[model samples]
Target chain A: MVFEEINKKDWEAIATYLSGEMNQQEAVDFEKRVAASKENEAYFKQVKTDWEIMENLKQKNTFDTNKAWGNLYNKMEQDGLLDTKSSINKFKLSRLAEIAAIFVVGILLTTLLYYIVSDTTKKNWQVADTYESPEIRTIKLSDGSVVYLNAESKLYFPEAFEGDVRIVEFEGDGFFEISKNPNKPFIIKAKNAEIRVLGTSFNVNTKAGNDRVEVLVETGKVQLTATKNKSIHKVLEPGFIGTLDNNNIKKEINTDINYMAWKTRTFNFEGVPLKKAVEALNRAYNVNIVCNDDRINNIKLVSPFQNKPLDTVIQVLCELEHLKFEKQGNNIVLMPK
Target chain B: MNLILRRIQKGDLKAFESLFKELYSPLCLYANKYLQDKDKAEETVQDIFYGIWKNREKLDIRVSFKSYLYKAVQNNCLQQIQHHLVEDKYKQYVKSEVAHFHSDPAKEMELQEMNEVIEQTLDSLPERCKEIFSMSRFEGLKYREIAEKLEISTKTVEANMGKALQAFRQNLKQYVGVNS
Candidate 1:
């Protein structure tokens, strides 16, 4: 077949057709034209490459606006943009008010139940010591409750469980194995949510910006409630996960034990988002990962590996996903196939 | 610059504060491109600067301040993404086998560079072409949407897109390796 001369209009038409910006009829006509000649096939490939480049370019320019605002706030704080003394005063006053309210409530409850008030004094709780390094630490509570603190995690607890229940506060990711104490329930206070349990094993991850506090139960049953709203309470059974976000509680059946696998260095992921997976790798291995493909960043993966070397992981990923990786010192770069 | 550096080296709170103000937004913006979630991105950026401030006295500014900021932001963002991946992997142990892979870093850089190239190319185009292209692509408006935004007819939108694409392709073909 004789090859027709390709003009600038032809190139634009091909670009539009590939971009899916063309009308239905226009696309169909363009496809027909491409199918008519070998030259058209070659031209289509060229156009396709050009279009991919354009898409890549556009994706790169779009930055997350929310992050920008956060940076500004932090900078202002560091620069002493706000009155430090006033801010500290405000914090102290709010804390004092909270304590006073708790005291008033405690007094009222004490009057109603003298026996419960007396029992509160005998409880012993011990919190884990603070660690300067970002290392996952494990603690065994007095009541035989086991807690695994993620890197940079902090926990606060009393010397021992007292009164009607056992309470502990955590500010980070932690996994718990509560002792079977039906009479004295175990309650974990993490940010805006609370996890209550009666002898159960579960993972509670309350990372910042994660609107919901996630609870994945491995054994027994767990109850999750948003601290801000008592009405939002969810009961979760073994192989179940619950989330409390925006004062809303959502429960979903989850049979995956690997979801709580931070206790082990091995990470088992299934259809996890690329960005999320990268985050996990960095935290687990303390390495930097830079993605060259924005589209791939959102792509999900399904794979399981145990304590694999980072290079091996990257190699397997590249083979399975048809992707490429470039190492620049401590940083690993991810690119498309 | 040397005086500011000396103050930062000495752990002067004021000097650190001033530096934070100057570099915070750009660093955050840079991190946002990698991690799409705004809150997470912000947290990562904040944590980095806070870490720097806490260790300001020991920090060695061996290179341009820009390089140091970029390096810190890059490391933090990458770490955040990798941490999530490990969590997902754990979640997958009992569940069905599925994998989530991140984009290639080289490709991301290439794309960023290409974007810069495209922006320059667009700037060189006629004002009407640039506006139409931005309206159609950036705003994600259909031809009709672009027409409405630009107060032009659908035909004009189509025509302008065509022109813009043609100009872009001609300018970018070499970089994109688009040879027929």
Candidate 2:
């Protein structure tokens, strides 16, 4: 064993190896050689001990005695160590509880700051994007309520809804999502009729002609009144279709769930007959669809379509019935192949 | 020191702090010798001193107060080292199970000599060599960081570190033994 013969290179190698500058494979290989000889291991251990004792330089020279005492004193106070033994443990626990309470309040304030910094609502007084077109449009009112207008429709609304009731007038078809405010109600004046919204709800006035206006309630309650009669009114609940003409108000349980399919482009048909389905599809997509045979009327559909093109829904629908749809004149005809 | 200890036993916080001011750094360094972690070493020493003051009224000590602190800090560090051994660290010192309470008077004398040797060895190095050594060991600056900060090449820093460690090795050669 080479006990007293470590050269300069060996010392430098040990220094770099202990500094962790040497790669893992190099350190492992070096460790194997060092552990093989007792003298080599002792030298390695000596270097390791020297590395540890290096801190003595820091302690003896640079350690701030006053700062260290201040820290220990603070810790002792926190742990109730400075207290006379008679009441030490109790003070320590209360001090810890006080510190914990400060932390909890700090966390709550930080969460509130995050919310204030990243508030999701777009804050502006200027209204944007109002129009009538062949495509759909969405308008966000000042109250955070949204209005979706179908083609051939437009709204007359202010930059911000004013007064106790947020009243917006519109022509043709539009979907109103009135925001909830118990103190202020939302009223829609469309085609000589009014819808008083007491709560936040999704209700679509699918279409409003000179003589008729239709309302379908998706959620919450809406009272539809014919402005011409004043006494003719109906409270429509969810899944109820309320219609107001110049004479009377009519409401019924709406089985045609595809009323919003025009703006949403999503169709949910459950056990609906092909003929009746075609009728609703015509009103929704504004397309002409004809399934002429009475035998095809009993062919019930139980499929759903979301944002699908009219041709895709037709093709899938035909495949399920062993039939096909072809464009014939202005009508898309569904017939047996 | 014994007078201060007697005062501390009578609930004299000022006396306790006087002893703390005198020995805090050395005891922290002593604990670091076993743990190799600065914060844990400081924590062990503070806890030992805190335990003494908290239970001073019921204290029983046959050894000197400094001796008691060294013994307590060593035991705490050994307990921590053993605890980390359960986490599979420091497996190289598995035989450090051999160091649970090795607080003999000879060991204390050897450590006292080693501390003096470290001071002498560090003081004897070149000014730049000592800075590099302290940067690597105390400030935890990498050779690259030290090189950048000092505007020297990394090779110079490494060589200085090597020279400093070698100087201490030569000075403390009296402490290393030929046993397994």
Candidate 3:
């Protein structure tokens, strides 16, 4: 009724508000004006009705659905909208590729983790104290390497092999069976000699007065360098004996099977000299033996001594050589009857 | 979620028709907002949905089907306006100024009056909003930095900042950001 009172500018603002274009403040301001007066309220209703009719006319009069569909279908035929399963197959192929990439990445990660764990296992070592004893001492190293220290020997080994080499300072004797690690070499540091071996079992001995050191190889190889003269070293093979003395260093095929008798206490000597048998017995028992008569040189002992007591072996020797024996403190004197 | 679109991609004509019928008029009206010519707007929308049917198999839409259609119509409208730059009737229409009108002096006087009203409204803002707004905009500090300075959580700062921005929008209709 009072549509004329609501000016054209006011109509545009009302239309803007109807279309959700007015911000909160503008909408509130316009709504307040409508609520204040009956004329403004009637203008609001009229504008809202006009917008509703316009939207309906847009769908009914302007958009002809059938005509548009006909045009779209003709255009589609011209464009050749193909019907096939190729696109589906393409999606499947891409999915397979994704799975394959994930598999390869998984393998790479596992290999990397394995190397990291194994490298750490090999590189880390704990600290331990040094080792020495009078009797034969079997020492298992922190790195699982082992050395058998013989009696009358002083082996001042590192507490743990915390380095790239397994090392020990030696004075008397030892039989070493080191674990096989090519990275960490086993070394014997002696008074007159230095013996180095990489993962092998070997015997080491130093005579009284600290004059000599002997290394006999059993498995793998051994290299003995004279401490007094470094250039004087020998690389001895299995069944080879390397002797390092104050003045000389030499290696020979180990034919003296009794060279291990000090550790084994077992011997098979056939027609060996009287003095030779006594020497084997003395070494096996750690005793001193003196054969004072010249006639005993012609005597020969043809027998096997298998872990026999020292007194029995000596009695057998004295009877066969027609000799008498007297026992001294840690000593035995043999004489012709 | 795009089940109808998937059917359309498989050459289902009925699915395509349902889609076209549901969106046809609304899309035309949206395009007319920028083109200002109902016939051109209808033609643009028909071509877009027609192009959709032509290349249905290659339609790789990540967003909702309706939103994708609306966005495609918007872009096409902008492109047409750019190509026909000499046509001045629809050249100045931007998406942000959807229902704005160029009035003689009445609207200008209204905007001038709006500034005074905003000054009164802004000066009378809630105490908390006034403090948060000055700390953020006037002091030129980041939300997290402001939170740390004020000894509050970042979420509390964000909420207060939203309150302040809402207050500004209530006074200044053209002001944007913080939701822009």
Q: Could you tally the backbone clashes for each prediction? A: 50, 0, 2
lDDT of 1 by residue, B71-113 (tens): 7777777776666666865346313321222233344344445
Runs off by more than 4 Å, candidate 1: A1-131, A208-211, A255-258, A269-276, A282-288, A292-295, A298-303, A309-312, A315-332, B1-180
Residue-level lDDT for A151 in candidate 3: 60
Q: For each candidate, what's the DockQ? A: 0.12, 0.22, 0.06
Which has the greatest DockQ? 2
lDDT of 2 at A47: 79
Report the lDDT of model 3 for residue A137. Answer: 62
Model 2: per-residue Cα lDDT at residue B97: 44
The lDDT of model 2 is: 0.74
Residue A31 displacement in candidate 2 (angstroms): 67
lDDT of 3 at A217: 92
Estimate, for each residue in A1-337, the C-alpha lDDT of model 3 and write its tens digit.
1444544455445544665546899999989878887876754564453333233232333565545655665566555553355578888978699787898789779747744653455434332222333345666776676766556655565545654667666666667788888888777777767788788999887863467778889999888987666568878877667777686876655656577876776886666677777777666666789876657855767787887777788788677667888987766898887
**lDDT (CA) for every model shown?**
0.69, 0.74, 0.66
Sorting all predicted structures by lDDT, with the top scorer first, yields 2, 1, 3
Among residues 3 or more apart in sequence or in different chains, the pairs in candidate 3 whose N, CA or C atoms overlap within 3 Å are A128-A159, A129-A159
